[model samples]
Target: YSIFMCLLMSCISGIGRATALALARCGANVTAVTRTQTDLDSLVQECPSISPVCVDLADWDATDAALQNIGTIDLLVNNAARTSLQPFLEVTQDQFDQTFSVNVKSVLHVSQIVARGMKARGSGGSIVNVSSQASQCALRDHAVYCASKGAVDTLTKVMALELGPFQIRVNAVNPTVVMTEMGHLAWSDPEKSKKMTSRIPLGRFAEVEDVVNTILFLLSDKSNMINGITLPVDGGFLAC
Candidate 1:
């Protein structure tokens, strides 16, 4: 039997790196789409199963051209996003545009490109979009970020509805503050972190594996019946 191959594109954050490594460990050939060649080189070193396609997802033409060459895709993850922390009234136009460009537009572009391949191949596939708990709940200084994730959740549902007949599953994974390097940097202050963690029934932020495991489940046949749902790996944060 041939090994399963999954094309996973992330913004090369800690979650993306961990997810890529885990997929490789499971014996899937991983093609990582990232903008930073430095992160790409380091990730490829960490896991030889990964191949690199360096393209800034914000560039529609470059991303389209790049993915056009990836051949076949059995699974896809749209994990690229950008955010600026500011009050709704303080948010600038550039901040809003940049956030939407990467957070919302890229998801549509990448998914469309990959889904076309899946549909044409007729082998079916799974798509997981990394969203956030902020999409469901209001957070201070997260107006733009929250709005973009909400778009992703809606996109997930619509994709699932439209693609189900083609046997392609689409879902979104919404996680609370994950303790990645970036996560830690953003939430390392004990006072700030506690405010958020206290609301979670789990009483702690998520680890990298928490999100990765969920993505793996969605990609595997174990979740064959699941589609269009935004599954939260946030330790019950959204429930509160």
Candidate 2:
């Protein structure tokens, strides 16, 4: 584990930040990538073991350039995503493009770059794409976001198929609403929260640690046989 090298995207906050910190604690040499310098600085200050790389993942050219500099990575977490909530008819082209750029295109680019390195090294690697349950279950006002995540899910399957031969494993984690700061705000209304929770068999929203732990399991040798699947950390929301 101490020898594990992990490159995590969107480590500025939320599930990304939690994953980065947990990885560092597990003795992985973590490279935390995010867009803001201040947040990167804060992450490093909080966990000095993490090496921060600041780059806007939405910018394809810049993201590719930045990732090129980071040498061989054993594990990669494509956790950067943009969600634009709008009705199908109200969704603008910019919103659709932006959502796909961050959620789908960026993941494809980063995974391609990292998987190449893994193949070259001949050691193989694990890649986890942070997708949403919305990809499978539709929600109102989430047309564009859901489409982008659906693309991500499809891309993950294709990547897994192609890379499995190289001993590379690719998977996506689709979680129900996790109680992050933003999650709390978005689902703050008690009635809304209750309605949502009633659907989940677990009777509550996912915690950041719940998702982080699943991610760690996927990255570990324990899940070596698992590949080409999207594991839902949704408290069985999809089951119902």
Output the number of the TM-score-best candidate. Answer: 2
Tens-digit per-residue lDDT, 1-240, candidate 1: 012222234335578888878888888878888888887887887776688888888889988888787877888888887778999899999999989989988888898988898899899999999999988999998999999999999999999999999999999999999888888898989999999899999999999999989998998899999989999998988877
Q: Report the Cα lDDT for residue 106, model 2.
A: 80
Q: List the residue pairs that clash in candidate 2.
A: none
In TM-score terms, candidate 1 sits at 0.94
Q: Count the backbone clashes (under 3 Å) in each candidate.
A: 0, 0
TM-scores for candidates 1 onward, in order: 0.94, 0.95
**lDDT values of the candidates?**
0.84, 0.85
